[model samples]
Target chain A: GESVGLHLPTLSVQEGDNSIINCAYSNSASDYFIWYKQESGKGPQFIIDIRSNMDKRQGQRVTVLLNKTVKHLSLQIAATQPGDSAVYFCAETFPGNQFYFGTGTSLTVIP
Target chain B: EAGVAQSPRYKIIEKRQSVAFWCNPISGHATLYWYQQILGQGPKLLIQFQNNGVVDDSQLPKDRFSAERLKGVDSTLKIQPAKLEDSAVYLCASSLFGRSYNEQFFGPGTRLTVL
Candidate 1:
């Protein structure tokens, strides 16, 4: 079965530094990829999303980069803030509309 | 528009007991989804509903779990004979149309603890 996975389980960064979180997906048929941030005791929140046709998408202070060749995805947060601390998940959607999520990466921003 | 709504923000039950959570999607939304999120993990789709019809429930523990969307308005997810592993947060979300059509809006979620 195809799966989406992350390279790291945890990421720590200073409040003013740039942070990078990596993910890898093995579903070639996936046409869309989305990033979600979940705070403790809350549901996941939509971050940024990228379509197969595009390589990158940028949002408020977050950027999602998708590399189909390596089946890899990355989320870069500019000027990491304390609010950025959360569990990040990457999800891929296939033509069937089913989405498979990665294990997730926990980001900790040091204030 | 109002966001998705869920009830019983928290619950604690023993194994073999029955528990249920309710969700009401955004007004006019046609797609509803139920997901389970364990501690430190991502939300896993348990079932999906398009209007009042079941779209997918392959991942749901059918023998112990059941879900239904009555009148395409509110939905309920019931877990009977709950197990220890059932302790987690149950999240409900809805999209404007369908999974292939729009992004999802999530609810606060119902946290369950099976003791």
Candidate 2:
């Protein structure tokens, strides 16, 4: 059985502060992970992705860290803005399989 | 490049009423997907298609849900006698192919309200 879940259902951070959202997966066989951000009334948009081989990956304003030993993944948003407030989801996928998405964490940026 | 397109940005109907949603993938995309997302939750895959062929539909509620991609380009998802629990956003996504490593671009989802 494979399960992905977030540590927190909601997170609030001050504008311009850093935000870290955590996720856990039960499938050790999972080799790839992706982060998606969905705004109100819109479908999810891709944020960043990390392969099992890499422990950390960085994008423009986001960073994904993978801890294979702990079966945990985390996404860090730098200088969070009002527009960055959205529901974030972490999805895991093994080779030759569809991705399994976590419940998701709502991020609220307080100005 | 144009992204995936879905129709009926919003739909409201009473329980037991049948409703259908449509999706048109990006031109040349060989793979398409339909997902159901309840409020405050992530999208749950209902079906996947690889050029008009069913790839994965293990989570789809076959008893009440049906979907088709007749031409390998456009798709339709229908819910028969919808339930109150069926209220959610139906999302469509597409990729170049059913590659496990490629990103699937998503479209504006259709909000379904089954009262």
Q: Name the best candidate (by TM-score).
A: 2
Clash pairs, model 2 backbone: none
Cα lDDT listed for each candidate: 0.91, 0.94
Query: What fnat does each of the candidate structures reach?
Result: 0.48, 0.73
* CAPRI classification of candidate 2: medium
Q: After superposing candidate 1 on the true structure, give the runs of residues whose Cα lies further than 4 Å from its correct spot.
A: none
TM-score of chain B of each: 0.98, 0.98
| Model 2, span B1-115: residue lDDT tens | 8888999999999999999999999999999999999987788999999999999999999999999999898999999989999999999999997977789899999999999
Stretch of 10 with least lDDT, candidate 2 chain B? B95-104
Q: Tens digit of lDDT per residue, candidate 1, span B1-115?
A: 7899999999999999999999999999999999998887778999999999999998999999999999999999999999999999999999887755268888999999999
Please give each candidate's TM-score. 0.97, 0.97
